[model samples]
Target: MKHFLIIAHKAHTADDFSLNDLPGSAGRMDILCRCVNSALFLSHDLRRDVQIHLLLLGEPDPGRVIKFDGETVRYLNPDERSSGSLIKKALDKDSSDFEIRSTPGVTVRDANLSTLLSEFKQQGCSLYYLLEDGKEIREETLPRGDMVFILGDHNGVTEEEEAEIEKAGAIKLNIGPISLHSDHCITILHNELDRREKEY
Candidate 1:
């Protein structure tokens, strides 16, 4: 399975924020919504083997993780609003750790990076940190394993967050010299990986 993890540093944790005005009180949630949309859709439909993790660190709660299961997830349409609504519903719940069964997928979790990384590690995933200055992503450079790509929101991952990710031994990868939005980066990654896999 392929996993894309995005860190939203100032994503609003409260449910009072307007979905239309994602950049205002929601703290640029539009960026995240775009990212989620990219991860879920390509040309026609969803990628069955893919998963997305959103690490929300904002208002009322700091470490909230929203996971999207493409394999068996249900009721998740091919639009940003569907994902955004589900995320909003998850945030409104009062529990720090909980799961919602939707679309044949029992998903959503509230956890920190440490716990999330640990789970991924146990699943035998090769973690890769997406950064501009890191090594360029290439077909030959890609390792053989369950891959997990970690990225940040509009402002990008903080220095401290990068440090922790680095400590976890995630190889840093740069898609290109020019900086790209997180969602664009994700689309590029999916396209590249899909092309390379079909080649082999």
Candidate 2:
């Protein structure tokens, strides 16, 4: 399975924003929402092989992880309303590794990059950090095994966070010369993988 982790440094842990205006002109819930949409749906349908992890590093709680398992996820529509509701509910709760049977596909946990990377490493996932100046992404750069792609929000990953990722041995990768939004990056990566997979 392919994994994507997007970090929202200033995303609120509680649902206290306007759905009509998620960007809040200053907050990042908008970006997170878009990221969720990208991770969950493709061609207006669920992707059975992808797993998206939203690392919420915002107020009330940091190191909070919201996971979307496409294989078992249900009741998800190809609209922001569906995704927005799920995101709001997940953020409003205060727990570690909370699971909802009704929404079995989505899992929320109190986790950080270190813990997540460690778990993926144990599972034998090739970790790659997306950066603007990193090595270009190509078929040769991608691993034949399971892979995990990490990205940052609008503010991008901080120096401290970058250091932590480096410690975890994540190879730096760049998709293009120009920087793109988190969701756009996800789409590009998935497209590249899908195209390459079909070629082979």
Candidate 3:
């Protein structure tokens, strides 16, 4: 099964660049530099060909277009009439070939996590996060054998989350924060993919 892993940062989260402007965050030296970090992390312990997607969220907007780094970015442009048509149509979970386009190794500034998650699910992906809410994932959210990971925020759910995850039959693990370069992320991802990965 093709899977997409989402690394979410709320629109308000502090980073090195402006969160509202996509290119600034996507092109900034520190953010762009993370590409190597992500590559290392994802490629390290992964047993599958996993594609990581970095999703940035911010408040909804109308029809504002911003130009940066030789690319023109168009937002929802808050004033466009939807004819009552909802984004759900485009984010349908049943879509066979659906996909989400986000700036990799960078921050994505948007306001709706649910909308973003729906889009990812349409593309046959499941969300894995170390959130405090303890409900970013559900059994019915994805098929069995899917993997979800937790890092950084070990607020104490590591044990309890393991039980819930066991019940759903999803792989769960906690990797403490150890910042690495891009290639390092890839290295870590490959280790996770080793034949005896369960033993890691």
Candidate 4:
């Protein structure tokens, strides 16, 4: 199964509240990119040969993008439905093993989307908290296999989105940055990543 990374908030996840009137589509593209970059770096460091791709499928230029090693970022235009349609098409076209990698900050918001994207994969879509500095990613500390889902925030999700995911048989998770010291968000992030790693 091919893997796709869809992150919603590079910085938003840590905020006490959601951003107001932000361009919803593009706001989390950076979160998505960071997700891929973190996972790619983790795979590389661990010498895992899991090839992945990044598809920026949406409107308004499909958002501006930047590239990191071992990842490709592109903007895709899906007929009228945007991401939902485009991802469905990609699933049919690829017709191979695939899974989606996302961060809770984004994936949880649209759990139905996560459910749809998982259909094409041998394993279900996996989500993670990508915590790193600009220079490196620490994957050994990340949760693996089925444990990724539990690394999400315990509260604050909207009722509508939560209902959809719960109805879909997927569990909601969150990783809180609020409890950590400013210089230690990444530290707490690493610990949280490790916590799940061992939980499984």
Candidate 5:
């Protein structure tokens, strides 16, 4: 499976944020919504082997992880507003360390990046940190097994967070020299993976 973990550094963690203004009131949640769409959507259907996790660290409350499993997800559209609505519903529910399902194939939980990384490690997922200064992704042999890519939203991941991820054994990779939006990066990564798969 392909896993994407996006660090939404300033995305609002509460449902009270206005969906109508996801870019402002939701604290740049629109970026995350677009990431979700890019991660799972295809020309006519969703990618069943993909899952996207949004790590929200914003005001009022923080450290909420929203996961969308494309295998069984329903009611997810290609539009940003529709994805935002699903995210809002997940935030409305009470969350604990245990995941609570807000919609089909979507779950919410109270967890931090470190804990999630540990879990992914335990699951034998090959972790890759996406950054512009890192090694070019095409230079490495992409793993055929379960793999997870870590990326950040507009503001990008902080130095401390990058340290933690590297300490957890995530390999740093870059698509190109120029920095791109997190959502755009995902789309490019997916295309690369698709081409690789077709070659095999």
Candidate 6:
């Protein structure tokens, strides 16, 4: 399975934001929504082997993780607005340390980057930290088992977060030398993976 963990540094943690202003009132949630779409959507269907996790750290509350499992997900569309709606619903539900299902194939829980990374490590997931200055992705061998790709929203991953990821033994990788949006990066990564799969 393929997993994506996006750190939405300022994404709203509550369902109080206006959908009309996802980029503003919702704390740049539009970016996260787009990332979700890019991670799981294909031409006529979803990628069943993919899962995307959004780490919301905005006002009212923070440290909430929203996970979308493409294998059993329903009602998910390619549009950003629809994705945002699903995310808002997840945020509205009460979640604890344990994951709470807000919708089919969608779960919410209270978790931070460190805890989530530890969990992934325990699951034997090969973690990759997407960075601009890291080694080229094409030069590295991709893992056949479960893999997790860590990325950040508009603000990008902070220095402290980068240090934590490195300490967790995540290999740093770069899609290219040019910087790109988080959602765009996911699309590019998916394309690369798909090409490799075809070759295999």
lDDT of each: 0.80, 0.80, 0.30, 0.31, 0.94, 0.93
Candidate 2 pairs with clashing backbones? none
lDDT of 3 by residue, 1-200 (tens): 32333322322123333334423432322332242234322222322333333332222331111101102222221121220011212222221223433332112233233444455445554445433333322222333343323232112224553444344433443223553433343344445444234443
Better of 4 and 6 by TM-score: 6
Encode model 4's per-residue lDDT on 100-136: one tens digit a residue: 3222111212222344434423355454332221112
> Which residue pairs come into collision in candidate 6?
none
lDDT of 2 by residue, 102-152 (tens): 266877778888888899999999999999888878834576688999999
- Candidate 3 clash figure, as a count: 40
| Tens-digit per-residue lDDT, 1-200, candidate 6 | 99999999899999998889999999999999999999999999899999999999998888999999999889999988899999999999986999999999999999999999999999999999999888899988998899999999888989999899999999989998789999999999998999889998
**For candidate 3, what is the TM-score?**
0.34
- Candidates' TM-scores? 0.92, 0.91, 0.34, 0.35, 0.98, 0.98
Winning candidate number (lDDT): 5
Off by over 4 Å in 5: none
Model 3 error, position 143 (Å): 9.4
- Please give the distance, in angstroms, between residue 117's alpha carbon in candidate 5 and its true position after superposition: 0.4
Report the C-alpha lDDT of model 1 over 49-157, residue by residue, as the tens digit.
8888888898877887777877776676656677667777767666557665433542555788888888888888899999878887873367556999999988888
lDDT of 6: 0.93
Q: Which stretches of candidate 2 lie over 4 Å from their true place?
A: 97-102
Per-residue lDDT of 82-182 in model 5, one digit per residue for the tens? 99999999999996889999999999999999999999999999999998888888878998999999999898899999999999999989998788999
Each candidate: how many clashes?
A: 1, 0, 40, 11, 0, 0
